[model samples]
Target: MSYQDIRSTFKLISGGLSETIDDSPKEFVSASITDTRLMGVVSMCVHWRLPENSHLTDLHQFFYFDAEESGFETYRSVLGNGGPSEVQEINDIEDYLMGGLGGKRVILTEREVRYMLQSYVDLNLRSGLSLPEDKDEYEFMLSPRVRLTDSEEYVLMCKQCPGLDSPYQVINYFLMRCVGKDFGAAKFLTKGYVRTNLFPNHKGATLLRNVIEDSPDAVSGSNTDYHVTDDDKDFGTFNTFKSYMCESLIEYSGKFFLLITQITLDHLKIVKYEKISEFQVSAAEASMMTSRPEFITVTDLVPSAPEFDRHTTKLTSKSMVTDYENGQLFMIFQPHNDHVKNATYLLNDDVLGVYYLLEDNQLILASYNLSDIRRMELDLAESSMAPYIVPVSKYEFKDPVLFDFINSSFDDFEDFVATITKPPAE
Candidate 1:
């Protein structure tokens, strides 16, 4: 069944299932078993805190639920990081113990992802078994916001769609359908990104649109049937897009990062900003969530250095951008005092990862990846989390030099370079 159908069934059977983990109870919830990450792990979170000390320290021995066998089992990965363990099968499969993005799963928010790395020193994390220290570097590899996947492609075989014969027109329709609900027709066309912006010079679609227009007479004869239906026009919009895709426009269309959709850019342009100015001090509220190294080496930020230890929502604008480097960019804008964070970000280059700098907070296109972001199990009772993420760029960084300078200024830049630029030590 589809996600919607299955979701309806879950609501009907469970009678408003609520999830309560730790001391907190999430009221009225339902569960489903579709796609999820960390197949062997499922969490029940009633609170955000972890216990003082979790008995389980060895990342290799974590338990996972085996959906196929209807029992708990182990999953073997050839490229293993070893955070999973095998527990004995349970005869009683309770309601909360079902599969997928349900249960007390910890949603990796921006603050949560930052807390994970700097707070915990024990747990090692993995993203597809590939862990990068900083968020921006990791975010550089995620799926882009505007992408067309192939398991089942949307095809407009019928024609009545406007720009049916134009590939770009079809894409515009798709984007229009996929964008935010409130975008009206005039706002999009008046001051929006046009297809011509992406393929500057009308290079790709120019010839195709021309061919269709000129072929009406040649297909049959002079004035054979110079007519098209409303349905045909709509479908034509869809067909032009599908035909170009099938003819390999997507595969060979080199510049995928040229983001051009009516509603997307509108959403990106923000009027207010909360930005962190300097590095946060060790004693500030920022330091309260993130843990400092116990040894207190020179490599660490001097707890008294007001310059490197201050925390604000502001970040340098020109930060280096990668596909999903760590989706960990911590940017500061002039308007807001707090940075909007995201553990997941969409990239211009067709990738997705944990992005720290939030889209809503700043007009800039970067997220920060601290040197400490890691993966660890949160033990409820103690307000501590060890989440890891990669920061990604929402759009291209027009300036390269400034981008590098901002990221390298952070302490974690050394670690970020090592993980993403080289293979892990064997």
Candidate 2:
């Protein structure tokens, strides 16, 4: 049966039950299987009105049950006051509908009742597994202050959704960190956006803005689509080779290291994130770096061994950005030694691929027998997430001068180099 028909039937049955008990104040607004996350899970909500003399407002009891082959099992029962009451086990649907199986009800304000209902709709109705057809309508009703949790992928699809205005760009950035075959380096890297006022006095600024109106490019993280126009300007002396830059502080073996990553779009529209520079700095220096817009301290990373100790290091994070930028990216790299021969790897999972830096400072992005790009192309054609997957780029490692300087600055230079050079797994 359709959800509407089922809802009506449930409401009728609930009204009948309340009439038999001669309870006029108690109301059953909904008794349908509101939860769509799992096929067999159902949600039931009932409102209990206070006595005529009582000053307190009404209460709502939201009961969640799991439908099994044998019977319905009451798993969770929550009151509108934000308290979870003890679940009174109900084995049958008839018994549950006829009798109010929720053990107790707590007093709740009108705001609290509304919050409880909205929370249930946000979580259950808009689950990843059960996406509603009309997302824009639901998104419009949700408060602008609503929190965007990890599971709200459907809500993320809506243009009017809260959180980031550019949902697709945010998704594509993290898609590289998520979807993909595991070859094991850190899958996700914390990423942020930055803007530079580099060309304040450049000639023809106002005219340029007028000629090419500022349109937000779907694939770009920036509001101004200058990359689209500036890309053509690269033909002459106007070197349009621009990059997106951001910095992060990583803790390693009790020391903080400053990491700067540069992202650039290749000719094919694929986005590549290259680790441009790194420095071992004091905590004070790390804090001072945040004064600049590009640098931000990442507080949550678990400290690991220093870079060179890892056999496979993540050199870049990448994503397949489309002409109409929507969705996320997959990863690119795996260890040179572990690459399976004749195997077509899923492009989506490797957006945050690993690499190995040689003694000469040349970075080995990926190594395998299959020399053709068609191996990845073939996988992309057959995969469901093909649109989000992008081609990988061979990014050159940063200058070795900084690498040499940092190593020399180390107190135990020889010992540190020896430990770093050793092939430790990431």
Give me the candidate number with maximum TM-score: 2
Candidate 1 lDDT by residue in tens digits, 1-426: 111122213211111111222223112122212112112123221112213224321111112322111122222111112233212121012222233222233333333222222212112222122222222322321323223233211121111012223233333333222221212221222222322222233222101100011111111212112233486577663122111111111101222112211211111221111111112122233222221121000122223322211122111221112222322342221121011111111111111111232222211222222221121001101211111122222222222222342344333433433454587679
For every candidate, C-alpha RMSD to the true structure in Å:
21.8, 24.9
- Each model's C-alpha lDDT? 0.22, 0.29
Q: Model 2, range 299-351, lDDT digits (tens) per residue?
A: 11112312322212112212111110111112233222111111221211211
Give the deviation of candidate 2 from the true structure as CA RMSD: 24.9
